[model samples]
Target: MYRYTDFDAAFVAERNAQFRAQVERRIDGSLTEDEFKPLRLMNGLYLQLHAYMLRVAIPYGTLSSAQMRQLAYIAERWDKGYGHFTTRQNIQFNWPQLRDVPDMLDALAEVQMHAIQTSGNTIRNVTADHFAGAAADEIADPRPVAELIRQWSTDHPEFQFLPRKFKIAVTGSPNDRAVTKAHDIGLRMVRNDAGEPGFEVIVGGGLGRTPMIGKVVRDFLPEADLLPYLEAVVSVWNLLGRRDNKYKSRIKITVHEHGIDDIRARVEERFALLRPAFIGVDQQLFAQIKPDFAPPAFKDRDTAPFDQAYSNDPVFRSWADTNLSAHRAPGHAIAQISLKAHGATPGDATADQMRVMADLAERYGYDELRISHEQNVVLPHVHKADLPAIHAALKAAGLATANIGKISDIIACPGMDYCALATARSIPIAQEIATRFDQLKLEHEVGDLKIKISGCINACGHHHVGHIGILGLDRAGVENYQITLGGDHTETAAIGQRTGPGFSADEIVPAIERIVDTYLSERDSADEAFIDTFRRVGMTPFKTALYGESDKKQKAA
Candidate 1:
């Protein structure tokens, strides 16, 4: 993990101090709620359904053991005992009082973290692959690039206030684990024809009211030209991007309105001017940041013990099958600590659990942690020999939920409960579905399903790409959810098809249950997952079940 330099430390403390004073001003009426709203939001504070919610950025989703402990501390001291990890690779503290957020920022600054750019229309948190350094198929660790971009984008004079919130994601691996297709700017680390590493830049891809897959602006952006090229892309968008209509304000729309060729041409024109001016930091700055992310040295222990353990423990075998990922290092695996424990909230990790994970990270694994886009915590580079001990320690902390990629592992946004723009609730809906599935123990039977929920058409919860997608809507002040089926998010990604009429908030769960039951009865085999069956048969059964109707023949008659 990258430690903050003194300059970084001082900057955060200064920002926190300013925020603390602002909070005092707001409480004393020197700042009205309207006056304070933007200021508060700029610092990652939100006025939620009940109380204020504070979102803290975990840049590139990498955290040190110490930082994890601090997050746990914040969860314990300020708000609810639990914190929700979000799809953007950020964490949200759901119940913080407005007055306490400044203090929370202060605490974060101590660990070289802050909430700046966590919110606001400015470029939001720069996210990357969770398994950056540890992934077997990485070209260069994307974090250094992410960090460089973070520093560049943070309060950049030019892009401080864009037409809309800008998001950027980097992935070192060729496997596209970072959901690059769904971001405003997607930088996939790639090699040129000559084998020199660079970025394959994709622009315009986003999931919103208008979901469009991004187009490649640059086929191969060289290593040294990365920052300048990115600046060029943003500059072109800032100048030519939409501003009149908020719906069409995104860069994706800009790219759509003006074709990729024009955008690329404009970007190239912009790049020529910007490239020469960035003489301050080049490969040297990267060289400085590289050492901070040096891979941890592990004991060259025998893997024979791990094989023996797996043979003896069937439970561990199942967990290993579902939760473990390959690591770059020999005899090591990345461990996913699933928050989707049956009936519990999908991404809520308690303060105690965070502490336990920190301890586990320091002890059994490398003193490193990652927050997955699927709302799970990852302990990257854990020795296989430590799996038993790690499992036991996790079990003790109530953090050993072996439900990674299962039905219970849902991705949801802070819908009506927290987001001001939400028309319906997402968390509670996710909870209901998870609980129902757990009670039936039918997650395994259902198999490899992604049930995503977004409060509205913004699609932050990624309802557009879910295997069984649910979008919450407002129907005359009543919360309703629309279901979409047969969506995918991989190389085979597609928007899910809507079954029929939307269901009331209360009715959505049982409706989902009916859909699941229909799948169970109609499926070819359990081996054929919900998605495979949906692809094979189409949405007729699920639609019939949801709409409370007979076949189309009866309707036509």
Candidate 2:
């Protein structure tokens, strides 16, 4: 993990002190709610439905054990007894009081974390593949580049108030775990025909009321040109993006109105102007950041204990099968600790669970932890020899659900429960679905299914990318649910197609069950996953299953 330097520490301390004063002024009525809105949002504080929500940035999803412990302390002391890990690789304290936010920010600063740029129109937290440095398929760790972007974009005067909020994601693996296609600016680390590593830059991709996959602006940009090139892209968007209508303010909309060719031409012209400003400072910083991410000292250990546990304990074996990913180091595996315990909220981690994860990371995971975009915590470099002890610890802490990529492993937003923008409830729906599937015991049999739900079209839960995507809407003051089929979030990304007609809240679960049953009946074999079958046969079968054959016949007529 990157440690904060003296300068970084001083800067955060000053920010915290300033914000504490600002909060006191607000409480004392020196600043009205309208006056304080922009200030609070700039500091990652939002007034939600019931209370204020504080979003803290976990840069590139990397955290030290001490940082994890600090987050646990904040959750236990200030907010509710738990914190919600979000799809953006940040954590949200949904019940934070207005006065306690300054204290929370101070606590985060102690752990080299802060809430800066988390909620503002400035560059939000730069995210990457959670398995960045440890993944077997990674060509290079994307964090160094992400860290560079973080350094450059934080409070950049030029980009502080863009047309709207901007997001950037980087992925080093050929596999697109970072959802590059769905970001405002996505960078895929790839090699050129010359075998030199560089970035394939994609811009203007986003999902909201109007969802579009990002377009590739540059097929290959040299590694040294990243900072200058990114500056140019944002500059182009900042100038040409719409401000008259908030709905059309995003860079995606700009890309749609102005053709990609025109946008690319502008970006190239701006790149030439900005290229002189970033001569060598950014590359020099990259050289400094690279050493911090070197692989841990892996031990040569006997795997007898891990092998014995897998052979004997069915529970541990099931967890190992579901919650582990391949690691670059031999005898090591990436352990995904599920926050989505059956019948519980999807990404909410109790303070005690956070502490346990911190301790486990300290004890066996080389003091490193990662938060995945899938709303799970990852011990990215867990030795197989220590899997049994880690599993036992996780089980005791209620963090062992063993459904990483299964039907129960869902992604859900705060929805109406916390978000004021939501039109309907999302958390309860996610809880019901997870509980219903757990009762069926058919999750393992279903295999590699993703169910994402969003309370509104903001798509915070990434409903557009799920194998079975559910979007909750309000129809005539009643809650209704819409389903989309055949979505994917991997290297082959595709937005789901709607199944037509909406279901009542009460009918949504049974409707999902019918769809799953239909998949089972239609699949050639168990080897064919839900997504595979959906792609093979298209939406006809799932639509028929949800709305009967008569629905299609009526349309035909």
Candidate 3:
């Protein structure tokens, strides 16, 4: 994990002190809720339906053991006993009190963490592949670039109040684990024809009322020109993106309306003006940041013990199958500690669980841990030979779940349960869906499906990008769940099509079962996954099964 520099420490400490005073002022009635809204949002606090929610940034989803312990303390001492990890690689406390937010911010600052840019979007948490430094397929680590953007964008005087929030994501691997296409700006690390690493910059990609895959503005931008080029992109969008209509304010919508060619032309003009002035931030600075994220020491060993454990222990065997991966280094493996614990909340990893993860990272693994966009933790460089011992520790700590890239592994938001803006509850719906899928034991057979649930149209749960996506909406105070099929999150990403009429909370799970069952029966082969099958067949049968085939407006023969 990257430790905070003295500059980083001082900045957060000052921000904490200021937010604490602001909270006091709000409590004493010196500042009305309206007056405090922007201030609170700047500190990553929001006034939800029941109480205030505080979003704390976990930069690039990395946490230290001590930091994890502090998060546990905050959860236990302040709000509820659990915290929800989000898709943005941030954590949200749904029940934070207005009075305690300052204290919470201070606690985070101690861990060199803060709530800045977590909410209200100003270049919100520059996320990357959770397995960036550890992934076997990575060309170069993306965190140094992500962190560099984080520093450049934080409280940027030019961009504090844009028409809408902005998001940026970077990925080191050819595999898009970070869902870069679902971000306002997605930067994939790539090599040019000349064989020098650079970025393939994509713009205006996001998931919301209007879901879109970003357009490639720069096919190959040299590694040295990242910041200046990024600044140009944001500057163009900030000035020209719509402000007249909130629905049309997002950069995605603007890009769609204005066309990518026009946007690219404007960005080029801006880049021309600013590129020279930003010469200070060159490849040298990136080289400096690399050492800060260097891998920890590991002893060379063999994988014999792990092979033996898998041969003997069934539970360890299952975990090894679902959670372990081949590492780039010999004797090492990547352990994906699942956040999906049977029927528990999908992304809610208990404070204790976080501590266990941190300890494992500090001990058997590399003093390093990563939180995936799927809301799971990764021990990126654990010795494969030590898999048995690591599995034992994980099981004892209650961090054993044998579902990764399976239906039980759901990406969900704190819906009506915690969010004021949400019309329906997302956590319980996710729980029910996960439990149902677990009972079926058909997730792996179904294979590589993403099930995302969002509480509302904001699309926080990435419902737009799931192979099987669900959106929860409140109709006449009754919770109604909407289903979409065939959405994907790969190189060939596609938005799901709506199945049909909405289902009541009680009817939602069964409806999903019908769809999955239909796919199972109708699929050409077991190898033809849910997405492939859905792509082939469309949602007509799923709709007919849910709403009788006769309900179809198109006259049936």
Candidate 4:
């Protein structure tokens, strides 16, 4: 993790003090709600449906034990006893009082964390692969570049306010764990013919009312040119993106209106001008940041305890099978702690749960923690020998759900529960689906599936890329849920196709069950996942299953 320097500390302190003054003025009637909106947004504060919400950024999803403990403390002292981890790998405190926000900010500053750029039209938190340095398949760790981008963009005068919010995601692995394709700027590290690692830069990808898989603007860009190239891309879009209509303000829309070729040409032109200004300063900073992300000194330990537990305890076996990923270090595993436990809200962790995870990370995980974009906490470098003890601790904390990438491990946004822009409730729907699948005991049977739910067309839950995507909307004051199938968020990214008419809230869960049952029956073998089956068989079978034979016949005719 990147430690904050004196300059970093001073910068955050000054920003916090400014926000404190701004908060005081708002309370004193010096600034009205409308007047304080932008200021508060710049600080990552939002006036939600019920109360104020504060979003704190977790850069590249990396956290030290002390930072995690501070977050738990903030959750307990300022807001509700739980904080919601978001799809962007940030945390949201939903019940913070406006008056106490400054205090909360101060508390976060003490831990070298801040809420800045977590929201608003500027670049949000620069996300990377959660398993950046630990993933066995990584080309190189992407965190140093991510950190460099963060430092460059934090308060850049040119990009403080863009036409709309922009997001950038980076992944060093070939497997695409970061969902790089769905970001404004997606950087996938790849090796050139010379065998040097570089980035495959993808641009114009976004999901909302309009979902798009980013186009590869550069097949291979040298690692040294990353910062300048990124600046060129954003700079071109910042000037060309629409400001007349908020609906079409994103870079995705801009790229759609102008051909990718034109956009590429313009970015190249801009790069030629900006490259000199950035000669080698960014690379120098990147070199400095690289040491902070070096791999932990892993111990040569026996895996006998892990093997014993897997062989003896079915519970531990199930959890280890589902929640663990291969680690680069020998006898090490990546442990994913599920927040979506049965009926619990997805991406939420209680203060006690947070503390438990913090303690486990300190004890067994080399004092490192990561927040996955899938709404789970990751102990990226846990030795296999520590698995039994860690599993026991997690089970006691209600965090040991063996449902990673399973049907019950859903990704859902706050929706109407907290968001003012939501049309219907997403949290309850997610809870119902997870609970229904758990009760049926078919989650493991259903296999690896991603069910993403967004309360509206905003796609905050990334519904557009889910294998079974659910979009909740209000139709004539009643909640209607729409379903999309075959969407993928991996390297071969594709936007999901809608299955046809929306279902009532009562019918949504059953509809999902029908889709799963249909997949099970139609798949060539048990090994064929739902997505592969959907792709092979197309939407006819699932559509017939969802809309009945009569509707299927009607469409056929």
Off by over 4 Å in 4: none
Q: Per-residue lDDT for 63 in model 4? A: 92
Best candidate (score: lDDT): 4
lDDT of 2 by residue, 1-557 (tens): 78787988998899889889999999999999999998888899999999999999998999999999999999989988899999999999999889899989989998899999999788999999999999999989999999989989988999989889999999999998999989999999999888999999999888878888889999999999999999999999999989899899999999999989999999999999999998799999989888888889998898899999999999999999999999999899999999889888999998999999999999999999999999999999989999999999999989888999999899999999999999988999999999999999999999999999999999998999899999999999999999988888777888889999989999999999999999999999999999999988888878888889798898799
The candidate with the higher TM-score, 1 or 2, is 2
Q: Higher-TM-score candidate among 1 and 4? A: 4
Candidate number that wins on lDDT, 1 or 3: 1
Tens-digit per-residue lDDT, 297-390, candidate 4: 9999999999999999999999999999999999999999999999999999999999999999999999999999999999999999999999
Instruction: Please give the lDDT score for candidate 2.
Output: 0.93
C-alpha lDDT values of all predictions: 0.87, 0.93, 0.85, 0.95
Candidate number with the higher lDDT (3 or 4): 4
Q: Which tens-of-lDDT digit does each residue in 1-557 have in candidate 1?
A: 78888888888888888889999999999999999989987888888777888889999999989999999999999987889999889999989888888888888888888999888888999989988999987887899988888888887899878898999999998887787877889999998889999988989878879987788898899889988998898889988888899999999999988899999999999899998898958667777888888888877888876798789988777788788888888889999999888667778899999999999998887789999888999998899989988887887877777778888889888788778789999989998998888888887777777899999899989898888899999999899899989877664557788887899978988998998888888889878888888888887777787765665766689
Q: Which runs of model 3 end up more than 4 angstroms from their true locations?
A: 551-557
Residues 103-132 of candidate 3 have per-residue lDDT tens digits of 888888877889997877477888888888
- TM-score order of candidates, top first: 4, 2, 3, 1
Shift of residue 99 alpha carbon in model 3, Å: 2.5
Q: What 10-residue stretch in candidate 1 is worst by lDDT? A: 546-555
Candidates in order, TM-scores: namely 0.94, 0.99, 0.96, 0.99
